[model samples]
Target: MLALLLAALQAAAPSPGPAPSPQSPSQIAAEAPAAEWVDITPNDLLVMELAPAATGRPRRIVIQLVPPPFSAPWVANIRTLARARWWDGTSVNRVQDNYVAQWGDATEAKPLPDGLLTGTEAGYTTQLDQQDSVVAGHVEHTLTPPITALRRADGGLEVDPYARGGVGFVGGFPVGNEGYGSPDTWPLHCYGAVGVGRNLSPDTGYGAELYAVIGHAPRHLDRNIAVVGRVIEGIEHLSSLPRGTGALGFYERPEERVAIRSIRLGSDLPAADRPRLQYLAEGGATMTRFIAARQNREPPFFIRPAGGADICNVPVPVRAAP
Candidate 1:
């Protein structure tokens, strides 16, 4: 009887399959069907033109603002700033190595540009309050299984990477949300993320000063600062700037700052000049495969895959629209 039972157990065991082939993230993205890509709307684009230094070539940086239902207030403020040309004369005042490159009225004394709606600052505070209330109300709310299940279904495993609950994307921007079910989500401070700079008071920042993450992802700043957008193109213009010699990456001398010629909404520009961009759609089969590829590095560069990917590490791919 014991011999028969042992033989039956051995027979019941499943046969192992061949090891899965390794794929680079680029390959996975390239293999994604065209239907999985989404075009970036002009309304969501901020085209910033910087005054040329001795280089004589004005740098054009394109930033994609987050859509509504997340960071709406701050987004509104940024749009207002752009529309009012608030950043037209502002300059890049700080460039910290492996940190952020900040730009705005370094003096912080410039009056809010004309045409900005009255009580804009108050509106920002109110919106933040509303967002916080919503988050608080849903703190205990839970539903659905974690993203691990989805990852598993896609032949991948969750390594619990990133400091946030579950990292994903909303409207093309990488977002950190409360696991599988909750609505609590915030834009992550990944490399090239553009955030509003503030003072000691959280509500003080009214979208005047903005900074881009130039180094490692500062996950600690997530949800703490108002991250309104991400640099979709020309990040090298800011990232490759000279590092500041002053404290906190501030240029010690005003002469060292880089000037901004103008910051315009892409929609405000002529159709011929508007940037045509497309980003890989999130929450699709292609995105899943891309994330998996990132999590599992292939053999040439990595013998042992980390089997995990941080939200910041997996930047959503963007390119000029073909």
Candidate 2:
């Protein structure tokens, strides 16, 4: 996993927070979870169990998610599980220069056994039709000061402004949640981000096979599909794979393509089999230092300071289970 994340490594540029638009009664009530969400807001550090069953007592991991806006926040004691069953037959579909790395079974392959979304909701299918869709439509628009400020095409993720797939950021993960109203949220080709290769049809992602972004953040693929997970560690393994010569970056030689041994959810594994992981809740000293360090470039390589920082440039560090 670490190898893949390093290679693939890789959003919510929405309206400014602090003053939520007066939500309707239902909307207000629906926000209870967001409110009760254990306050994972940026800057705050909360410890989450890497694997609830990994140990007799939950093995702890420590890391901070750069508060609100930065993608790829700091991580510690986190392990990427072996790749899981994704759109099985899908192959890497498209790869553009300094843009994105996409994959799917464009050959019109069928989903491998035991790897398809069973229903419209639940499981990793995480339908955007919930309280907060993956990419909220309003947030996509309403580019205001300090909000929606990420460098993106005029239209948001609904349609690829670059006329590719889509591009944008959702939370810390760079994605283009296009067609978000009807709620079309799929993974885009963001560094370290993952996507199930598919064909022209949207529903092609049966979650049997998947791919990780090997290059630049492909903003054009935003909101185009569902992005279930990301490279928490070892990103380089997938990213460094030799470029494929087939239709969509497919390896010209079979040996060139990295082989997938197997994939299973950490939760599904036995106590002994599970990998440890911890997602640092946002808002904490870790982030404070990170943000400041990023803004000023104080590490002292050259002595030039950025004066300001964009959400994309910062990365949340991931490490071993503490």
Candidate 3:
């Protein structure tokens, strides 16, 4: 099973595509690991809820993704695999500033005594934002990802077929599409988004591996990877890690990579595990106020507003229920 999974992952992103658009090498880092399913739909049962720290007070945060003139968001529910299981929380291990903030076991640290998957890798893997694809022989999963983003200032969104765009928000999710102006919704690979991991192959993952976004906006990657979810909380932990000096920006030494205490699904947690929380409503009045505040942030850092905001700059807001 592990051998088959590994082969499948290699087939997806076979180290060849037209010259990558000038998005960023960081785009490569934001790349996703493979999963059994290429698509995440209403049928797939999953919902991401932010769990707070020892502080007791809910670690409230505003998701920085939705477009302006809208701020408050609502809670979102993702379909699970029908049957439920608990997944634990993993620690952030690698940190590369303005690039990515990653955490999880590189390979399953725990060796399955008899190899449960029979032929597959075991427990050292944890979920991060997106897996970085290497140039030489590294493979990526084949994803017909659908991006949802706001059109450019001219009312036209990214139309280049080599890339993808539709530009919009769903709940707290950022997405894009293949058919322009059509009703298709795939995942968007915005900064800090989370996805499963795989080796140099496709469908070789089982949703255990994951990564996070931490750099430039890599829009061209839409519909090309499996976007599981975003880091609804605790980004600072990963973002503040030391930068890697390695070629593809990996931590130079093993010790530099952070550690994962454990990573599990919120559902898997005990009754005390469920954290009380609420996401700001995109259409709510508060969102409208927040949009204006960011779009025209009179911050001391800026002497001038870019006068326009990119979809990547938008923040999906979350806060404790008042």
lDDT of each: 0.73, 0.37, 0.42
Q: How many collisions per candidate?
A: 0, 91, 69
Q: What TM-score should be assigned to candidate 3?
A: 0.54
* lDDT (tens digit, per residue) of candidate 1 on 146-210: 12122433454344344235555656766665444344556678899998888775354777888
lDDT tens digits by residue: candidate 2, 37-84: 222222222122222232444433222222222121111101121233
TM-score of 1: 0.79
Shift of residue 285 alpha carbon in model 3, Å: 4.1
RMSD for each model, in Å, please?
Answer: 8.5, 18.2, 22.3
Q: Which of candidates 2 and 3 is the stronger one according to TM-score?
A: 3
- By lDDT, the candidates rank as 1, 3, 2
Model 3 poorest 10 in a row by lDDT: 68-77
Q: Worst lDDT window (10 residues) for model 2? A: 70-79
Which has the better lDDT: candidate 1, or candidate 2?
1
Candidate 1 residue pairs that clash: none
Off by over 4 Å in 3: 1-93, 107-165, 201-204, 270-273, 298-305
lDDT of 1 at 248: 93
Q: Which candidate is the best by lDDT?
A: 1
lDDT of model 3, residue 269: 44
